[model samples]
Target: MSIRISAVAAEYGRGLRRSLDQVIGQIDEAKRTGVDLLVLPEACLGGYLADLSDADSTLVHDDPGPPELSVAGPELAELAAAAGELVVCLGFCEIADGRRFNSAVCFSGEGVHGVYRKVHQPLAEDSYYSAGSGFAAFDTPVGRLGMLICYDKAFPEAARALALDGAQVIVCMSAWPTSRTGAAANLADDRWTKRFNLFDAARALENQVVLASANQAGRFGTLRFVANAKVVGPGGDVLASTGVDAGAATVDVDVPSELAQARRFMCHLADRRPDTYYPPHSMLSVS
Candidate 1:
């Protein structure tokens, strides 16, 4: 069975009400387009922080944190209601047990299905939120699904772990920005944007699974986001893309059949040699 999916590359500011309105509008559009799954950028609900710089240790230590909301809060409940039967995956700042986490939540009219806290943090983001312990896949309306937030997709092991656990579709939500040090004259020529696209294709190709990636757009604080939302086929083909702009990339694909075809010749997951794998330093010493 084929399922329609959409990845949104849009800007979300610090206004909670405005952000929620945008999400509802997106859901309305997704429903009209018959989108079974809608993926939104990281921190789409409450918005990410202005700067992630740790240049001044004092400022890093003294800075106020992201706005926190409960996964079971009214915000998510409203989102679930707005989604109706359409499955939606969106990033938010989650507050659980008085602690804040950079989290992504999946839900429908039936309510929340799964939640994933970001495990890998670039720069000094760890100073703001705690890291997630592990990765896991869960059943969703579209397919067996896995989720990765921003920097989590940078690690091959994270996607591999989820694929091994039976994830057929992986959605990566990112608030990725343009170059930090050397600014690019054109946003399209930004190196970070290139890396974002490369990682999405590489991870999908290596895992033999469908990949849907959504990212933030426009500028927020010191960061100019790279809006390159796209859906990649199991064979690492770009099924649909929004390019480097604020829009939605939508595609319809038979995920199971695609996975089967990609793995037919050589199943990357099945062809494993874990026993021979050793630490890099240990391997060098042995050689």
Candidate 2:
């Protein structure tokens, strides 16, 4: 069966209120296009408020009873309301155990589905958030959906695990920096120059799963992110691409077809020889 998804690549560093408003607007557009799911850029709710130059004073606490409903609190409700009959994946700064984490939360017809904390936090992110333990894929009406916050997509293992866990579609949310310099702009676009190829093309080819990515745009305190939002097919085809920064685009995808072709050609998982592949410590030396 074919399904449609709307990917929203927006600039969200202005503030919480403004960012959420934009997200709600995007959701409305997605509904108009009959999208099954809506994916937003990382930190869409909180915005990329924390920078490396400033020391982190933000607090993080684990979900005690119900989720904290202060500033970062109301976004969930708004997201749920906007979702209505659709599934959504929204990113934000998470506070837990006195530490901050770059997290992506998924909301669907049944409310919040799952949350994925970024594992590989970059230099700018490291100062503000702690790393996540592992990866997870959620089962939804639109098939099994895998979650990964920006930076996490850099690692192949993360995507591998999600594929192994039965995820047919992988969605990533990121706030990647774009070129604002004179020399860089003349040569190439910073987004592609910094390596959008490896992330979009390689991931789809390796895992044999459709990859959808949402990125932020515009300048947020010296940092710029021009939207390079894309949807890649299993065979490394660029199914749908958006050149501009802000706007909505919809793509009708066949999840089953991609998965079937990937399995037939690669079959990497089936050919694995796990019994003999042990850790170095477990392999005793015969001296």
Q: Rate the local accuracy (lDDT) of all candidates.
A: 0.90, 0.73
Across residues 1-287, which tens digit of lDDT does each residue of candidate 1 receive?
99999999999887888999999999999999899999999999868877888644435444344568998789899999989999999999888887779999999999888999999998867777777889999998778999999999899999999999999999999999998988687878889988999999999999999999999999876789999999999889999999988999999999999999999989999998886675433445553
lDDT of 2 by residue, 218-247 (tens): 655545665777788887787876755565
- Ten consecutive residues with minimal summed lDDT in candidate 2? 61-70
Which candidate ranks first by lDDT, i.e. highest?
1
Cα lDDT for residue 214, model 2?
86
Instruction: For residue 169, give model 2's deviation from the true position in Å.
Output: 0.6
Shift of residue 233 alpha carbon in model 2, Å: 0.7
